[model samples]
Target: MFFTLPLSAATISAIGGSTWSNTPPALGPSWDGNPPGTAVDILSGQVDEYLLSGGVPGMFSFSAGTYNVTLLTEVAGYAGSNQLGWAPLSNLATFNPIFDGPDSPIMKQTIAPLEGWAFVINTGGGDVFSSSSIDRFLAMRSAGSTNGWSVGVEDLRSPTDYDFNDQIISVEAVPEPTTSLLMGTALIGLALLRKRYTKR
Candidate 1:
């Protein structure tokens, strides 16, 4: 799937300084409690509902697909304000990874685990801008023993006022129909052989 999440004013203030100004309003709080930890789910319909209910500025979109995301990179910029900036928090891993403001541009030199979560941080501000929100959009896919991909986002800013107009894209590989057919054939042959052996 594909999703676009715009940063909120509160998120900006949290990352950027209050003096940064040009902060957008806050978007309504709508997130699914999934992906474990603090990762929140910000689906499209939910965002629309929040907007209709008088939510804040900034918008995002998500699409569903069967692919594996081994790498994740954040666009360079502050979600709410220009003063602060968004940075990577940790290297991607199978377990829950935390991205704090202290670790900006958290880059992973190796390939990420087959399954897990990664977090980002907003830094460069103090006090009122200290908190952060968990804005997330997730996509999951799996077939038998193989694990696909799951992605999430955490705003890390307070409520009250913020913007959430950011974009996230996942790149992965999809199994071809031929590969699926071959696997299916192999399974069928194995089942037939087992049945014959049992009869014998």
Candidate 2:
């Protein structure tokens, strides 16, 4: 089965000193808990809910198959005053042993265990798909990273706001029909064998 996750995120603080989304607004809070210890389910694709936080990377398990991921939306601001226009977070995060077949121009890299790497957001949406320009290489404990986002996604900001919604990603794993058919055939054979034994 394929997984689908729809979420939003923001990184980087305003040029001037300010705080935006510091507190979960009336609209709602993305990161359920406190900073630096955000939940990892945001990318699990197991839930069909809107994810609004990203700090601690999740340990997502997947089988061998092409996964189609997309950036739903992205926004940045400070106290809702110096808010930047919300736009489609057109960023692409390609992992090693994987390729952005659709966005060929986009860049992809392999993440080592204990490595600290995160998905970067390109507000301009220019080759956000491409990793031409990237920041620090981080890792996740889930993937054997030396550490995880302890401060949360605050590092994305100059002062480090815990919004952690700069870039929301949804990954859908392609279905394998051949594998399903083989399993079905095996089950049928087992059932027939059981019936024969019962007759004896």
Candidate 3:
């Protein structure tokens, strides 16, 4: 399971500006109330649907694999001080920053099966917003046109525009051989355990 998120690779310092221009139009509205919608489900089809159940609306499940994350666009007033990180879905409080600023280069991160992680944006004033919540982040599939996923963020504590475009990112899955091997090894181990138990 892999994702390729490509944004503008540019930072916009202006607040409330049309920074969302880079966001794919197919993603639809910024604040649609329901997030991690049907599109998110499609993008993550590699994982069993059962794993995607029981999380907050914006939270998602990914199979154990290496994901290539890129900080495409950080268009916000707090773009410089804000940070993006991932935390377990069970615990949104545990945030590990992937990048300190918008200018950071592409990063590669590995996720474990059932680890259940979500993205979090920590503001300059220490305010934290999770993608698990609809108030902070809105996610949508790119209408199958880009074969990608996009997320729009509302950074302000008291948003004036409710644009939810403060931060924009696009994601697409990329295949990796190591991840397949890891999955195969786990399956083999499970099969061996089952055979040994059956003989008892």
Candidate 4:
């Protein structure tokens, strides 16, 4: 018999910041997607590199039109051919997307700074293996530009109070030894019980 467990929140927190160190240079437009700002651009290429460099995790924040946010997932290489070196989006059994913003039909007003909300991506699937959190916000296209829309990403795993613009956090991955030991002991005991029952 084999058993697998969803990683504990503590464990995920422990391995949260390791990816920042190996993150390549900024990929594209800055957080605003107009001109390069202090914030780094987290393009699909960057995500691919992060995964390839081992199971390192990092966070990126950007502000763009709501429609552009979907484009990130639709990027040809981002979701295809095991691009990120992680499970494909289609393979994801569940997603818990959290949108932090106001309640309004207008995309711009809905994503104000002080308001936000969270929702499950696919509730009908009824699978527990996968999940995601998406944070949305509205910002000007440029410092003075009037254009604005909801923009955010599906964060897989992250530390408490994770933010994209301010600083990129990375966590080192550490294998859980105690969990492994407990699992091994349980397996051995089960095997012994089966043998004794067969002999009887």
What TM-score fits each model? 0.25, 0.28, 0.51, 0.22
Whole-model Cα lDDT of every candidate shown, in order: 0.29, 0.29, 0.47, 0.26
* Candidate 2 segments exceeding 4 Å error: 1-63, 77-158, 179-200
* lDDT for each residue of candidate 2 in 34-68, tens digit (9 for 90 to 100): 32122222333322222122422222222223334
- Candidate with the larger lDDT of 3 and 4: 3
Error of 2 at 96 (Å): 6.4
Look at candidate 2 and tell me the lDDT of residue 72: 30
The candidate that wins on lDDT is 3
Question: What residue pairs are clashing in model 3?
Answer: 4-172, 5-170
Name the top TM-score candidate.
3
TM-score of 4: 0.22
Candidate 3 vs candidate 4, TM-score winner = 3
What is the C-alpha lDDT profile of model 1 across 1-200, one tens digit per residue?
A: 12222211111111212121122224333332122112113333222112111122212211222333333333324433322222222321122223322233322222232322223333344311112222332222222212223233334344411223222323343433445556777888899899999999
Candidate no. 3 TM-score:
0.51
